[model samples]
Target chain A: MSTRISLDGVDKTFTNRRTGERQQIFRDFSLTLAPDELVAVVGGSGTGKTTLMHLIAGLERPDRGTVSTGGTRPRLGMVFQQPRLLDWTSVETNVRLAATAAGIDTTEVAPILDAVGLTEYARSYPSVLSGGQRQRVAVARAFVVRPEVLLLDEPFSALDELTARRLRLLLQQLWLRTPRTGLLVTHNALEAAFLADRVVVLGGRPAEVVGEYRIDRPRPRSPEDPELFDVHRRIVAALT
Target chain B: MTVTHPVGAEEVVLGGGRSPAPPDRPPATGTAARLTRPLPALLLVGLLAAGWQLMAHTSDSALIPGLGDIARNLADITTSGALGENVRVTLTRVTLGFAAAFVVSVAAGIAMGRSEWLRRFLEPAVLIGLATPGLVKALLCVIWFGVSLVNPVLTVALAAAPALTINIAQGVRAVDPALGEMAHVYRLDALTRLRYLWLPAIVPDLFTGARLGIAMAWKVIVLVEIFGLADGVGYQLNLEFSQHNVAGVLAWTVAFALVMAAIEYGLLQTLERRAVRWRRVALR
Candidate 1:
């Protein structure tokens, strides 16, 4: 498998102005994901999971060391925790804007919206939609660009279990349809197991990779499957 | 349509107790709703007018002219073309001043928002501008420009621009950093970023600043005209005041108020609604 995303010896630190204390989030941290691989990086809060995602997405540069995406600037798609849809535009227009920015044709937006089950609500404003629907639009926007790499920062964490599960399955199907390299930063062990081809645990101060698990399961794997539950257990054990 | 957040259902503020089931589709905002929406405001204005008329009848002084007396004078002044000429001059000065101020403030606000150095350098000056009253600015303008149209125009620009600059700078500062990251990740171009992210983030603030600026501009123009210039609404009011034409003074005041109201509610409000159509206003 070709390495699609690589971080070599990344160091990141933050200083608290009020307390006058410096905290390191990452130090010489390295990670790599194979092309078309979906990897979920799971860790407790403030474990630099999001910082890693940001580095891969090119939203931030490592203070030291190199971060490369397929050895060039990758066409990136990101679904943030919030919908982050433009409040001035309609749902359709938001997706279309992203697509147009990516040099994709506007015609592609409708089919993508249809896939996300938001066709009827195409012209509806973001404020008018529910949280799930809005997040779905955000997902559609990310996928509509046909990104070379997709980055998700706890996209489903805000949702209740049911909605999060539904969105997880939807995201999996969308990823399967396109087959792009993706990195998901999530804290849920079960979700990490369910959606990712590989689960990587991040822990310790100035976070480094603690454990990695490769799931060789087939698509449409049941959540109730004993093998998957075992994997979930193992991942949780790694987390603790 | 009935909308439920992924977390849970939001409480319905409009229907009371029970959550209002969202319609399957969005409702058509009908003309009837629009027309009746402002009825309460109209009724309140009508009540104020009735109270004023009642007081005018009860009082012995002609200084506080009745609405009818003001209306007659308004017609008389309008027919003689003084009203038209003065209004034209005042509006011209305001438009010129406001346009210049808008451009300058937006540019300055963006600069301050973007760069720490520029912000530090200009922030003190902008604060000084904000604290300085429009009357003071008008006085300075009159001294510099000597009763020319430039006097009111410059005063209005100085008065209005600072408020806009401050608000816009704060708006820019308040933009969600996460959204900026999203924009970068999506590889959105500068134009798209400006249109989708920056402007929307700043528009509510822009409107706030603009409304305040326009009001300031209106006041400053009149003040400058009354103090220095020999033309415009303030000058016309001065002429009426010297002759003790209480009805004319009230008439001109009403005319000025009407113009301000028309621009504020009619033009600015309509533009704001269009710009922020995506906002869900609370059900009144």
Candidate 2:
């Protein structure tokens, strides 16, 4: 396996205006997302999981340290918490948008829609679709790029249990089919266990990798499976 | 023709009693249909006319004109080619003034939005322009530029651009920062970034500013023409007023207002609908 992203000694400090104080989010925080590797960052609220993703994505410059990717920071696709579909476009147009921006051939659009199980509702607007379907569209759009690094910021944390479970099943199938390096940030241990190849827990003040677990589970593992439940419990304890 | 229903449930009959579903689209707007206003719009107009007639009756003098007499005077102006000339002058002034305002406002708004230093320097200047009273600006323009077309155009542009600049700046500032990141990751060129991300984000705001600009321009054009120019609807109104032809003055006023409504509801509304077709309006 080859390394695609390297974050070396990255420090991000944000100041609080009201208190006239500054908080160092993370100092010398670092991780690498390998090519075709699925890594889940498990962190408590404001542990700098998102800041790490931002540094990797080049959305913001870090206060200190080096963050670079393979040769260049490769194309990044993000599936944010909300669908973030342009309110003025239909589903297919929204999907077409990301692909069109890349100047790539649009052969992958149909397959992507099919992967997310949103092929039939291509003509529907985001407002008309249910929460689950909209989030699925966001997933489809991110996966459409076939990015070298795909950052998902709590992609399914907002959905109900049943809907989240269904989407997890679909996302697992997609991750298997498209072999993109996936870095998901979530506080949910079960979700982290179900989808990630390895879970890196970021906690304690200024957050570091407190625990790392590798899942040797088989593909299409049932949620009710005993082994998966055991893994979920261990990850939950780590998070707590 | 067999009009098929969705999902093999039922066959719906059309005007010809066919079973085909007719493609499940809104009916194409015919020319006559497009010209027709909704019942509420017609009622609004009727109420305005009724109010005018009632006021004229109560006034019991030639001072306040009846709606019919005003309508007749409007027809007289149209037939005599005077209304056309006056309308032409007013519209030309508005168009030129608004076009100039739009270009400057959009540029200023974009500039101020993108750069903090530029915004800090230019924001106070725009605010000064916005804070200046329209009548005061009109007087100043007349004093500086004289009674020609420049006075009206300058006055209107000053009034329009500041508000337009503020709104467009806010719109651009309000764009999804994430979208810009997506654009950068995809390496979308400058033109693509503008067209796909920025332009759409600001267009609704641009139109809003434009509508206000046009309205202000027309009114300022009239004021300028009444005081400065020797021709236009405003000047013609002045002439009617001098002759104590209240009916003719009222007539010209109503005609201009009606024409403005027509242009707004017809042209701008059509453009807005085309641009924002995906958005639905829930009328209560």
Candidate 3:
């Protein structure tokens, strides 16, 4: 009853045109996340990490079995690798778009922008904003929906180290403020260790869960914390 | 014309207000910057005028009238009120033709772009339509509609529609699948999907199609008018040609060229800026 997202024996495959090869991304994979648990799914580049997120988001359907969220169709929010903001519209309108699509009041737009530290940028177009700022707006747009299940696909991977660190902290704060069941697909073990209640490593040719670690230590745990560092090391070891 | 967005220029976002930048330093200036400015466009025009004048002086022919004679004819035509009336007639034809072409082509383009079945059914016909000669269309229109307002307008639309269709179809096909996936994930409504994802994705191609459509419309409208219709600048040009009034031909041409320039620089450029202003920032 507490499960927010359940993938039951999912299979996904894609074709390579040039080589005429069929690459299987996932086969007989299953994942279940409890409500309000932040799970970080980490894997190598081509190991079906993003594919898993896509399947859950319903952007990609499973070839076999089912990928169900909440009830029939749970409200979903996503922060892509790129900001994916509407370039023609202003930042406020971009956030407002998701809210509007969800039939949430326009009033939530201002406060969400404020929370993301983008109040001044509300009227500014996405093109004018820095990469980091654009990503922040995307994050704000994702959070505005108060989604039943939030999916992030390497959301901080594109940012530089300092900006990535800052955004990681920002993402944590936002998630804490309104805790939702979420899946963050990331390559960064440190990021996985810092954010997730449980870190799942996906590996092998047709990726399934290779390893899972419980970071039982409470959050607001520092990057410098010895216990957190130990978890980060174990996750990285599993990924390699 | 050289279009410059000053480094750190405050753009007008939604609700039409510029968020001011810090006025700490004056905009960047250098020799390269000054040379790259739009002033060079005027210099190019001056050079072209000088070349034209020199050619007229050397040819010593009635067909190639001096610039001065052309200017005088322009003034005479303006005072007589024929220039305005002819321009109005021509523009009306172009507007009707372009509007019709735009609607039909965009609808067809979207249909073809979105569906494999529709694309297969229509793409060959569309290609043949594009390859069809404007002169052929003009003559056919004249035969069908007679030498009246309908002939020129219909001919322009038929002649121009293919280019718009082709361009818009290509634009729609070129839409980023990543964005499409994003829209799907977010579960945006059809209208919102079109407005945000589809429109922005197809904009570059749409503008290209519009430019091509307008240009073709101008050419087709004038051709039909010159051959069949009794009014408009093209008809006047035909009349001047029959009368051997070379100066009059040049004068009418100048008037039409000026209007086209105004449309390009004044209207289209402004619209392009507003539509794709985000690109400027993204590029920087």
Candidate 4:
């Protein structure tokens, strides 16, 4: 149920509306994700980390090259920097909407809500939920779709540090339970180190992979692990 | 591990703390409270009616009908069935014209909102339509189509559509691109996107436009009827005017106002409450 994602020689550019100056974000950039692999893309601001996720999610098309998902197109579920829940819909309905869109049985929504610690809030509208709770709903939404690929763009960056840490753990636990081709784009080095199996540091104006680090530590790894700090240090260095 | 908080505190803290308790309900001081509860509006109406009656008594002018005479005339017309027939005819014209305007305005609004070229091309026409008076439009429609049902309906549509188009266009433009991206990534079908995303996004604006459009349509239809049509509320008012029957005119005008008030409060407000129940909860 896993799918490998590959972006080959992808080129994307945007022109300033007022200045008419074209800024190239990705030029001959390439990367590949092994099936069931969790890759975290870490980068500084404006390094096109989000654009890369958009490319893989098919929200944006590469200007010149192709982005393929190992022959078969996988059902993609995305979590944005904001929770992006439908404010009018309840938590359970939000998850069910994604499941419906993916053409899957909605029976999975209850379990996913439970998994994300949102069972009590299932019937509550997103507007009433805390920031952390809303993100949990988003996580439940992404998982309930039974997607082959999950793309998260700075999903926990907006939360308080304590809340973000807890959610990172929750996300890790979920990934351990049922692995998918996961791509997490974030600027937080520690978060990247904690959840991703491989950390890919992207840098420069026309972004390219500056360094790649593979975390071979086993599941349920501690955020406070000394080895994680070392890896975090190296990723931060690569980012600079 | 799950995050823990005091049982009921999470909702308060998370919901940004209940919007400051809604300005403490005024203390219920016995009969004073009960009297004040419904008194302000009723007192105003009562005062206005009493003042008009006094003025009619003092002036002894035929044009200034007292409240009693107007009520007697209203009862006469109601029993005679002219009031019902004319009301039905006018309501029919208003409904048809408003419906046509709404459908066309929504389509044109979405088109203009989505396409820059369409917006530029259609914006001038909408502005001109808004600037033109209902009387002018009514007269033009009468001139173009003669003294038929077409004049009132066409005039109402032309008068109401511009404001509705502007409202719906603003709604469409205000739709969040972030949500659009979320919809795309989730692979929501066209129908689902419209139902869950696009429709909800524009609902507040839709309600606003509907209220404004219906009010405009009512006004325009009455004007058109006065100028051209032979059998509607406005025509009845005109007939009463020609005979110098001020009581008859006032009765018809009061009945029309009552019907519009019913539609506004009983129908539109109820629908808007149901549609935007989430907003109420969010505010709380």
Per-candidate local distance difference test: 0.83, 0.76, 0.82, 0.84
* B188-264 per-residue lDDT for model 2 (tens digits): 67776666667777778877877877776776777777777788788898899999999998988888897798879
**Ranking under lDDT, best-scoring first?**
4, 1, 3, 2
lDDT of 4 by residue, B1-284 (tens): 12122112122222232222223334545987756766776798799889999999999988998898999999999999999999999999888888889889988987887788999999999999989988899889988988877788888899889989988888988998888888888888877877788768888888888888887788887788888889899999999999999999999999998889789878998888778878777766
- Residue-level lDDT tens digits of model 1 in B1-284: 11122211222111122212334655669989999988998999899999999898899578878888999999998899989899999999999999899889988998888788999999999999988988899888998999676778788999899889988888989898777877887878988887788878899899999988887888888889988989999989989999999999989998998888888889999998888766753120
lDDT of 1 by residue, A1-240 (tens): 233888889999888999989889999888888899989999988999988987787777889999888666878788999988886788899999899988999999988887777777788777777788889899999999998988889998887777676677678678767788889999888878877899999998899889999989887555555676778888888988
DockQ of predictions, in order shown: 0.43, 0.14, 0.34, 0.35
* Full-model lDDT, candidate 3: 0.82
Model 1 achieves a DockQ score of 0.43
Interface RMSD of each: 10.5, 13.9, 12.2, 9.0
Query: What TM-score, computed on C-alpha atoms, does each candidate reach?
Result: 0.86, 0.82, 0.85, 0.88
Better of 2 and 3 by TM-score: 3
Better of 2 and 4 by lDDT: 4
Candidate 3 versus truth, CA RMSD in Å, comes to 7.5
DockQ of candidate 3 against the true complex: 0.34
Which pairs of residues collide in candidate 1?
B1-B22, B1-B23, B2-B22
Candidate 2 Cα errors over 4 Å, as ranges: A1-3, A217-230, B1-62, B110-119, B139-153, B170-208, B242-244, B268-284
Q: After superposition, how far is residue B221 of candidate 3 from its true place, in Å?
A: 0.3
Instruction: Give the 10-residue window scoring lowest on summed lDDT in candidate 2 chain B.
Output: B1-10
Q: So what's the TM-score on candidate 1?
A: 0.86
Query: Where is the poorest 10-residue window by lDDT in model 4 chain B?
Result: B1-10
